[model samples]
Target chain A: MTTSKPTVFIVDDDASVLKAVARLLRSAGFKNALFSSAQQFLDEHDSNASGCLVLDVAMPKMNGLALQQTLAAQNSELPIIFLTGNGDIPMSVRAIKQGAVDFLTKPVNDSDLISAIQNAIETNQTTRQARSKLHELQQRLATLTPREREVLSHVVSGKKNKQIALELGTVEKTIKVHRAHLMAKLQVRSLAELVKMSERLGIISSPLE
Target chain B: MNWITIVWPMMAASILTLALLHLVVWFKQRQQVAHLFFAIAALGVAVMSGMELIVMRSVSIPQVVLLMRWLHLPLLVVWIAIICYVRYYFNAGRLWLAWTACYLRIFALILSFTTGQNLFFSEITHLKQVAIFGGETISIAQGVLNPWYIVGPLSMVALVVFVVDASITLWHQGSDTARRRAIIFGCIAFFLLASVGHGVLVHTGLIHSPYLVSISFMPTLFAMSYELSYDVLHSAKLAERLQISIIKREQAELDMQTQRNALTHLSRVTLLGELSGSLAHELNQPLAAILSNAQAAQRFLAQENINLDEVRDILQDIVDEDKRAADIIQRLRLILKKADCQLQLLNVNEVVQDVLKLVRSDLKNRGVTVNSNLSNNIPVVTGDNVLIQQVLLNLMMNACDAVADAVSIEQRQIHIHTRWNGTAVQVAISDQGTGIVSDDIERVFEPFFTTKPQGMGLGLAICRTIIHSHKGQLWAENNNECGASFYFTLPAYSGETI
Candidate 1:
């Protein structure tokens, strides 16, 4: 898929503050989306959208932390930066514990909000990149036939071809051919790369045990 | 050396002593007119006793008759004095009755001097020696009885009727002191009757004895003196009790003042805790906008291709937001500042609006929608503005809490109304929460009485105190439909209109 430019999503109940923050973000050369409420944001949320959410923690319904919980349940990769008018310690601590990028109090300094947004956007990018890479790897793993997949699991578990052939009740030549074909399909240039790929796919467990 | 000579003089001296003591009392406290009348009566009685002694000792009929005629003057003085004393001391009597009695006695006195040799005799035929007080000899007059002698007894009967009538009026007044006074007056009437009856029996020749009317008059004087002295003693005790009660009332006022100050302080603290969150949000909104708008303006200015129009808009927004934040701070300062109560003429509707503005966000957060019906015709009221606002804030806050857990949006409504009720401006706050527990309706305004798990319970109590100090009233009642309504009234300003 073609990657789009990351957009900062800002959700705040306060209209003037929301407009002002959006203006600041625009001035700072950031693409931004605005939602006046958590429900509005939730309604318009896109899983595939790559960005960080700057959320006010004291909204009337579905406060920032509660939205964070909802997003977490949905396995969303959107990083959150909490903004509260008066942030208490326990609340800030809880927000940070629940995977919020930062908890900022309002009348937030421009540099602080900008930096927190930048940090959250970077976290979102890193998580999305990792997810996509895992998706690509899973696609590559799906290309192997059943016999090649069995051979790859045994080979990555540090099994020699003769021991693998004995366990599979197959000839050593057949086991070698299956391993070579699976390695080519997985695009590994060396045995170390093959073993690393097996570890990434969680196929290194000894099937005989 | 008859014992009558010594005893009559002794009785005269003792009655004179009593008169002198009361005269001194009347002189010191000139307001004691009753004491003055008692002194006059005692002195008259004393003079009568002296005259009686001379009559009893006279050896000739002419001497005895002359003394008897002069004795009527003292008798008339005593009768008038007793009438005046009873009238003044008891503070009750028929005025016409008293005047008639006095006039009748005066008529008898005139009759004694003009109608005959004396009121008791048309003529004294001879002087007779009589034995009295165990056979000591004293002279008595024997004569043809004056038909007008009946006037003397008639006057005494009138005096008795006057005293009895005054006593009955006093008895019907139904106070402990008045009843006691009535009893004393009854005694005076009985003594007067006995003296009159004795005088009549002796003068009518029904018994042979020296004229002892002066001695008989002594008991009536003694009864008058006892009543006067009892009054003096009772008044002194009353003055003492008045002093003690005055001191006690002053102490109680001081204690109330101290409690009021403490409650004011406590209420401020409680208000701060309750409003801090809303205040932070209130202040932060404008501050956040101001900061962001300013920074955005800076960014726009620093750019090579700066948009001056946008920058101007940003600066304008910044100024507006700054003013908004300042306004919030000013309102908060007004609420939290500790100051002596300074009363000023205030518009009730304005006070309601100010408090509603302060708690707008808080009520919104609790999902309570306030409906205000403020009457424009409300007259201005004199009150401490901040204190009145505090009262409104407290009531509104309670209204918010009342509806916080309501099952429906309709039940989360609060209605505040203000209007002039002729003499005073009244404000009522009604909520759609479940009505207060019928028993807790009044108790809710008592200090430290709360239904909320975390409530300090001083809100309603403090509100009431503030209202009372403003010469207003605050109370709560369950609404007919669904909730409790709190009502308070502030008297319209009666001073010069501002």
Candidate 2:
């Protein structure tokens, strides 16, 4: 997908700064998305896209910090890197506290900004990956029948079919049938894979051990 | 009466006319009490002289006695009025002595009516005709003097003492007017004593003539009038002198204020001149940007696969950044322009940005990094835009100079901060460099004080003056770690609108 190449969304009120920064990123082989204001970025941004935001701190209407808060409120995984012409210690501290990837002053060094953008994009991808994994596991868990889910949970806890059937007040053959269905639903081939999948889903912190 | 005897009455008439003229002057300026008293004394002398003429023409003892008795009336007034004249004019006298002389004259008047013919003489032995100049003859009374008649002479003697005492006191007090009064009244007293001696001798028949007391008083009266007129002229001269001196003092203060303003303006102009080179480089920044963008667009257009989108953006930035550089030059020109001080409401942040724009190229060239921490929502400040811009430029350029000497490029930093503190907006520029020497911190604002080579040293001094004229304050202090921080404040304009 085009998403494999990370996009840097830049929002700055100064057209010259926006142009210069876009040119720098384009030369550095980075995909650039330019917006003139924070509101513009919010209005047009694709929430499902995995990328990082490069925002100017002193924009009119809505500033970088305010945008950081809005994105945070929405549980957006988009990492934000702040750029400002007049950066102070307190402002950088506040931005960092709000989970900003980096706070840089204007006329920023190209390598510094590029590395920070790279770091932010990597973090966004890592967070999205983990979220999608959990989502996939939840989807699989949702498809299982109630009896099959109960049978699967006991089996993944290192219980044998005999032990699971005894706990369910059922025969071993009936427990075996429910386990087969749940394994197929979860798409796991072996007991070890089933345990590993359950662990990935955060159904348990660890297998029976 | 002989024509010579008529001389005394004519003299009395002239003296009366002179005194009346002075009385008219006194009426116009009633504040001079001495004039009023001098006129009264002169009138008394004139009337007494007339009475003496009447007594001299009497052909019998009863007639002479009657005329002499009435003559005591003016005699009483003459002594009392002259004493009052001395007191008011010189403002110096023994009150009791003057009162005693007056009371004795009053007693003499009482005896003249009560004892009748025994008033100034116990009895008149005979009346004799004395022939004089012009073949005119006048009657002279030969009388046995009453012992009690000594009262009149004694009072005259006391009157002389009062005049002498007042004159001496005036002399000892020692001012120009006092000395003049002393001399004037002193001569009057001398003439008065001689006049009285002549009158006494004539009354006792020791000399064959009429009493000439009134004529004797004329010189003293003239001197008193002259002194009073001199006092009026002296005060008028003094008033004129004071008026001239006050005008001169005000002019001198105005000149000093104007000079101070000129010095402040000159210092600002000189600072702009010194920063001209850096300011040129500042303009070059945007020009270089525009050139690079245009060249890059030309290269893009020539390519077989032309990137029109990138080329379009490049051309647009060139135009915009060129305007940015033009804006910087415009701000620099504004400060350097010669103009009168015009105060207005200004946003301090905008002023700060203008200063930074002019100095940006200089900072980059010198490897100095600047960080600004301007607070949002600062209120408008009241100041002259050009003058305030000059102050900001001076501080920023000074900051760049301060950071140039640091050990490393990374250590060379200038921080510009601003905040709104309720009543005023404050701007602080701090640098990380060699800090100011402890003793030189306060002296930095003094004219002609400098640590840098080739520095005129009026920069900080002018900055302080401009801020002070705006009813603000500017100061500098060394930072704990390194370098120094300079701060200034401008009062917030509180009007509803600019």
Candidate 3:
């Protein structure tokens, strides 16, 4: 998580379109990158770059939808905004369903493209933040001992120390000690906060009857 | 003058008139050999009538014999003419039979000249004056009949058989003119046989009568004249009908041409409709660029510290994009305009490149690539520019559709080739799609024939008509390995100032 200005990565097979979109983004005081084709974007793009993708839907090979699928397979968090010269209803619907932030037709209005880019960048930022937070939580969860991990699950499931100890064949004193250690390792002070952290990490199920 | 003198000369004069009439007809239309043969036959008949008149007035055996001796010459001429006339007019009859009849008649003429007083008599005993036509006198020869006289009757028999055979064949041909001609020939045959039978009876003295062979042939001449006159009248009517049909056909052709032009315009509009999205994209690229550049320049202008150099670059780009958009519009207008055929000298390669530019984006969108091999030194062709462009555009669009579903990128290529082959400029467009169905190759150019589900089937038909009107030819053939190729040739302008 480096703090930097988000770049709008624009991919279009048409050089003029790519240049025009890049110019518009630059005029809007946003940093931007340009790729002439989907293959070029795939080959040259920086996966670690903090950005939203502005893609042309009708590219020669590996079109916008295919690129979207590829990035999704790679777990890339870059939000996509589609720009197509001829956007039909079914195509726009498919793009939207595939998690595109916006499907705009060309000659796109400057305001609409800029707003779409802004929304896409905002989404990317939120998604990136949540993903980093989850990563940090997983790192912290990995440091817990097996007994402490079991106790954390029982605590998150709304189990009492006595019930946890009964399930684990331990005394209430040992269960309580494990709960404190796991909560401290997870950096949560209150029981509710601990449960929330466990849930974030997907540590265990909630309490049943 | 008595009846024999008046009537015989009148017969000669009438027969000579028919001969002159046919001679003039043959002179005007030399291809009518039948007319020429009929003229000769009538002339011989006229001469025979004159000789019979001389023989009928003869008072001595030597005079009658001498007159009868040369009369075989006219008879030989008549027989030859009849054989040739029947062959030419009816266009039937056995060749061997006709030749036999001619040779036999010639043998009789040679015998009459060489060995006998005449073909019918070896020697005349006396010249007998007979009063038969109400006190008019004519001569009858009492003679020992020439043993070879049977040759003349035998020849007549052969001529009659030949004519009857020809008439029957002509009748079997089953046409109006042929049936009429056959009936006329049948009457001539009967008259010829009757005259020959009468000549045989008179020569053998079976009946007491002056020789009337020349008079007996008059009916045959009349029948022939009737047939020939019928032909002349029928042909005149046919010529009139032919002229009317020709005018009607030209009118139909003009109407067809007008309809075709309308259809061509309609199809061009339909093609534009199909390509509207691509053309919009084409125009939109420049427009989008211009908008973006202008907006970007506006933003720069709005800045407190304006970047003059950046603004200048954006303005330049805007101008370039505007020109690009204008070019696309100009092309669209050229294609969309409806006009008549205006032939002018055009560089084929330039038109090809222009059409390729128009369809470039559409083809790219469909993932089809076009490769061109154009000869630099090819001669200019004469044609309507927009129509030629339409042909090229239609073919390229069809090629794009052909390769739309190709499995491989390599198979999605269209090749356009142009060359100058001495007299004409030839252009060939080939595609690596599924080659046309073998049976459909020729039918592809026929109107309303199509293989595509959404096709109007007039594209190739119109293309062929356009090419043909330019004095060019269009054809299609499947490539040896795969795909199909369409070829067209435009005649090269010969530098004639028109």
Candidate 4:
């Protein structure tokens, strides 16, 4: 199978491992960076980034698994591929403890690295996409006026403008004005666009979505 | 000339000696004082009665003079004891029964206005004056068993009952109650003996006169008189002086104790002053968190009308945080409540946690690492929690301070352990810092000794006090290679085998 460049974050204290992993990823056409230690990885939490971690199982200051802990603490969804030079069952047990993407030994098989990276990159991309959609919806909702937002609830309920006006105890003209403003603020040109906005933003998921 | 003529004066002397003994006992309720006085009084009654039987003689003016002199207060002293001992022994702390006795005394005094003639009628009647055994001649001032005399002795009995009853209550309330049982039995025995002695003089006509028969008991009276007058009086005087010396000593001890207590409290206050920052920070965090959370909810509420469920959740959070704030305040107040450690059943784990919190920042500042491997399931033990905390804190702090001049940061490590040993909870607080020499462990609990340049040497001593208060054991020992460990054990009481 044809594989694209897979993004991985390599965290370790040994300068050679950090450099070698970064070079290996570069050689394999993988987008990667070298974080000297776990503390540095913690300081650089990027839920917006599309990547996974290639961590050293045991490092001087902070081991690979401990960095995984730091990532978990920040509530990031980036996948992790634990790569320890000196591997053991206990280290593997710890790596798999927190839903790691994959556990691999140092000088990992190029194919295994590529496949795991592809999987992690794909997962991270999906997370980013979902987050962007939610952000867009939140921004759109933020633009709507207090009154227009109230009317917009009724509009989503498939109520006609006149019916919405009657239900809200307001004039039909006022209902029309509110609906237009709501449509404009939500950046939806039509009713179909509005339903698609609700679906895409996960405001309301369709039963068959 | 017979035993009857000699009886009045000797009885009066016996009563006088007894009254004096009672006075000393009343002032100084020391065991030696009381035992000496009472034994003297009982012996006096026994001896004077015996002497009257043995020696029959005439009434000298001096004898009448002595009888007249001692007439006033000895009976009164008996009544006083009846009231005082009864009140004390019963722990009644009430004066009504005693007050009634007082009034009855007044009534008896009022009735004595008619002269003792109505009480004891004196007659020089002719009778057989036999020098041989078995024949009796007597002129006697016979007592009528008048209601007044009966009132006094009966009231005295009532007082004994009051004391016995009080002791019974004490027996029920106290744990080691054999002492109370002994007291009650002793009083009961004496009461029976006195009643019989009084009966023999009144009804049996043992010597053909009340006064003469009493004279027959003179030898026994003197033996008792010697015990009472000299032994009780002298020993009681000695006991009184000893008691006064004891009181002075106790007073001095109490004064010194109060001073030491004041100093300790002052030192603690100074210690708290040093801990003011940590205390303030500890107090302020929850308060600040409470304020921020409240404001966040308020902002959320103000931005738009909040949902009922969301509002309810916010309110619940506010209530929970308020309780947290209140708990911080309560804990702070409790810590500052002036070292009054009341004894109760406490979980050892709590003491460990509390000491850690109190000294956490201090240890951090000193770069000392404390690892607590507390047994969460340690059983609740009977002890003073704060005092145990104090003991733990002292050891930890001493460890921390001891390593101040040491080389490595790793050396300043403190480890705490809690364990259940079937019948007791054992807590071991160990520190890998400076270790005490083997010679010093035995004398460490002694007062006014120190290895440290600035220490008062009272901390470990006081720790022993607290441990003993809980019926627990505290000792220190060096670990296998290095460091020192302090282990204390608290007993699980009354079938608590955890």
Q: Which ten residues in a row have the lowest lDDT in candidate 3 chain A?
A: A200-209
Compare candidates 1 and 4 on lDDT and give the better one: 1
Better of 1 and 2 by TM-score: 1
Worst 10 residues of 2 chain A by lDDT: A55-64
Q: Residues B1-498, candidate 1: write the lDDT tens digits.
A: 767788889999999999999999999999888889989988988888888888878887878778878888888888888888877777778888888888888888898889779889999887777676687877777889988988888888888888899989989999998898788878878877888888888776677676677787788788888877887898899999999999999999988887787778669768767877887778878988998999998898889999999888888888888898889889888878777788898999999998888887777556577899999999889988898998888888888888989867788889999988887899999998888998888899898998889988888888898999888999999999889899999998888643
| Model 2 lDDT tens row, A66-94 | 89999999998889999876567998999
| Fnat scores for every prediction | 0.70, 0.03, 0.56, 0.00
Global Cα RMSD, each model: 11.7, 15.6, 10.8, 27.8
User: Individual DockQ of the candidates?
Assistant: 0.39, 0.03, 0.39, 0.01
lDDT of 1 at B371: 91
> Which segments of model 3 are wrong by more than 4 Å?
A162-174, A205-209, B1-259, B344-347, B371-382, B406-413, B417-426, B480-482, B490-498
The CAPRI quality class of candidate 1 comes to: acceptable
lDDT of 3 at B444: 96
- Say which prediction, candidate 2 or candidate 4, comes out ahead on lDDT: 2
TM-score of each: 0.57, 0.48, 0.62, 0.40
TM-score of 4: 0.40
Tens digit of lDDT per residue, candidate 4, span B1-498?
A: 544445455565666666565566556756434334444444444344443333234344333323422332333444454344334333442466566656655555444444442222122122223343335453223333344445444544554454455556556576554444435534543553465356445432454433332333333233323333443455668988999998999999888766755655554554556566555544543443344344445544554555556546556655765676577667556655665446677878887887787776556445577788888767677776655666777777777776656667567677888898776788887877667888987687787778878777877887787688678888989888777888888886554532
Clashing pairs in 1: none
Which residue runs of candidate 4 sit more than 4 Å off their true CA positions? A1-44, A47-209, B1-246, B307-311, B339-341, B360-369, B376-380, B400-413, B421-424, B434-458, B468-471, B494-498
The model with the greater TM-score, 1 or 4, is: 1
lDDT of 3: 0.87
**Span of 10 residues, lowest total lDDT, candidate 2 chain B:** B284-293
Clashes of each: 0, 0, 0, 22
